[model samples]
Target: MASGLGRGNGAAAASVQLGLWTGDAIADRFWKFYGEETSTRAITRLQFLEHVGYLLFLKLDHERAQRAGRFAQQPVAPVDAWPNLALLSGDALHTGLTTLFDELGDQQLSDRPDRQTASVVFRDAQPWDLDRMAELNKLIVEQIDPYRWLAVPQAELGRAFSRMLRDCRKEIDSKIETGQTLTPLPVLNAITKVLGVGPEDIVIDPACGTGTTLIAAYHAMLAANRQLPPAALAGADLDAQMCRLAMLNILLHTGRPFADPAPVRLADTLKRKTPVVRSGSGAVPTVAICNPPFKSNGVQPDATMRDDFWAYGDFPTNFLQHLAITLPQGARAAVFVPDGVLSGGGAAATVRQNLLRNCDVHTLLRLPTGLFHRKGVKSNVLFFTKSTPKPSGEPATRHLWVYDARTGNHHTDTGNPVTEADFDDFVASCLPEEGFAARTESKRFRRYSVAEILASPKTSLLLKAHLTKELGDFGSPKEIAFEVADRLDEAAAHFRQVAEALPGQ
Candidate 1:
């Protein structure tokens, strides 16, 4: 909590006392304002949000610098200096914003990686066009006050910015490519719990969107009393705007200087020569967590990629293979993947077989449906540890535990969102502190040997322990559609297996 912000009383559950507004509330105002004000020559909702983020970033930094007595040396940082909005208006305000952004790009962020991301955030940012600058001024006055930015602590502001990211994503969700999805915080927590991130471990996300996964890992590290430097976390994403957002997100969470080089890089993870690095004082990544793109058509066949990366012919499998091969031995990873990667025949089967052979593939949790941004997409989290070379050439994995959280459960984006408690039973079943023998099976949890897994059709890892069928309450239309799609996927996998068993091609 900030010094001035107040909490609501018992009766007013959704109320914020002392006029402290939430990030969701601020985003709603921005979107509504954009719809009513923006015209043909104006910016899109995405561009408007980026501009707002820039202003917010500057305002937050100004306050931080002022408190530290370092504000005197910076170039015209004028956001918080104004006592109120009445002093600036119209063309003058627009020109001032343009100059500030220009100076920010040219002077402050002109270095290597920072310049790259700043170029994206401030690219062609013509604030004078079609009343956008005026709109921004109006929003700052009415919704997000500069005084509020100064008053809130960095943690609260970071939380607000995170919530704003989630809210704003819903507005621009259609603009991004298919298979790009945002992970809800609770889902991120569940994945991190399985990894059990420690103080000394370095964490990375290959497909880091908005840096939420890395933020979750940061918080987990903080819980263990870790002294988190900016170099403790690293990530990469193909989208430049996403890289910018991730940089801002991590900066806000870590309380790093505003001009530090982004921990995330704007490079295609599949093409990067070295996937993992031990940067300045940062060690080799010991834990990796990601929700990779499940159905990306953008990943085309390229000669630059290694042959093993193309084993399953999809981004999800490629990412899995990337982590399996790139992460140092004894590193742990938890990846969210679609069901096809688990049950598909041919290349998918070969990939699963090799994964089990090369890594200690330990736990498979069949996640509930409707957990992702895509409608009706079924998914799961695969946990494993990279192993060292075996002199005898035996498989690395021994026993695989499967937890079926999808059978009798459902989740939704709005109506019934996923909570961390929803994963409690599954997390307990993982037995993070206990060794393998202490684990016990339940209705939704069971263990299978490597031999049994290999003998299954298509070498499928989509094993489920829950045998009880769903009761009479057929869920919402989305749930029904998800069930249908899941069944179709299962049928397709089985058909592929049957076809492979035929005498001739």
Candidate 2:
């Protein structure tokens, strides 16, 4: 048992490394600065990077001004001089650094000042180079915000770094203006394994934040020798900021091939009666994947226009329902939803029932609390496929297999986070027949028939309830009953003997 438990722990650690490290590869790169004692003094990776990047820009500007003596032409203003520089405006500084880093071929500054400083100098000056400084300033304000380093709390440094890296892609794109390029490493690794997401598969992320999913999908398709079909990928977000970020993310990652009308649109999918189809072309997506916001309360829509909103009195529940409706028949979807959606009463329950009846829910990967920016909210990934009406005799779903990865798990919010390697065993467990047998214990994961699920009150498919069951160690009922009778008879005789002795006296 101890050996088995140790093996499970090892597998889980690997999954965490795979998933978290891959997703935050860029942030992870910046976080290496903390290796220097000076970097650790700051509250966050964002703060450290911003302060360092700002200092570098200042030093670089001063050097440039010194080289071009007073007798020389007027020195150009430092790109960081703009008021928005302090505000961490768009991706200018980040993109510039990314370009600088790429040119330098290293992430660190040199120990020797001259050699290190020379890496950032522009050897070839163009007639329009001064205007490029202005463009850099605009990119900083429009693409990335340095202020985010200060705005994020110390406890949420990991999330801050993730957000910063995601935003930095925009800064890179504002200068270059291209197709989706930067892909979140972790998500890309996961999507690359999907057999169905080739060039032929129509992939979409309705809530494609930063276009991470779409970019990953695009790369995965390319690797498969499938040419990216026109309109093959699409994304949408309720927040215009997210839509813009997604567009920039795609462009920066893909190296801005052409002016593709933003594959992203700003639309509230939940309340809107009509799906926001992109450009009146392209088939409905065969695959959809997203980590939708988990808000449960009444959060107002980004726009007052009610056309695309899903009108449930509650917020997140409406989004879940909306995702279900938008997925075309025979399509497959992997969505991250809060645990409340699985068990919440009233409207949420209705939605769950409708989904189970209409869709073939194959698996539920239960994620632990504190795995997200907003900690302590339980979440699950529901993998399901939409299908046409089947004959009455055919079974719609025979069993719902659940992998409980959240059990006995702990993760620090820093560089060390849960990753795909941590989920390797869980993923392995998901393999059709082989995974089912490799379970260290049946309690960790088990299957339930559809009839058993429907028989439960509220038809709640609570995986935890099914996975944990305690058994008594006592003998069988008949053996226990005989033993109890013998003890009772002995007690009665002892009482009778005491009474008889008292009467005779």
lDDT values, one for every candidate = 0.69, 0.50
Error of 2 at 75 (Å): 29
What is the overall TM-score of model 2 with all chains considered together? 0.56
- In candidate 1, list every pair of residues with a backbone clash: none
Native-referenced Cα lDDT, model 1: 0.69
Give per-residue CA lDDT, model 1, range 425-500, as digits (tens). Answer: 8887886457667788888888899999988888999788886873434557756775577456656766887899
**Model 1 stretches astray by more than 4 angstroms:** 1-48, 68-128, 141-145, 148-150, 176-178, 276-282, 307-312, 432-436, 469-475, 478-505
RMSD of each: 7.7, 21.1
lDDT of candidate 2 over 1-505, digit per residue (tens): 1111111111231112223233254355445434433323323433344433433333323333333356222222333333323333235545554454344322143342222222222212111133234434433432232222212222233343346654454343222111122333553445345324677777777667666777767767777664466577777766544554455445334422222334665555554533344756656778887666554433455545443433343555665666666677888777777777777778777766667766777677776534542233556777777766566744355567777767665442343456668666655566535554444335556676767777777778666623444232233354355336544554676677678889554
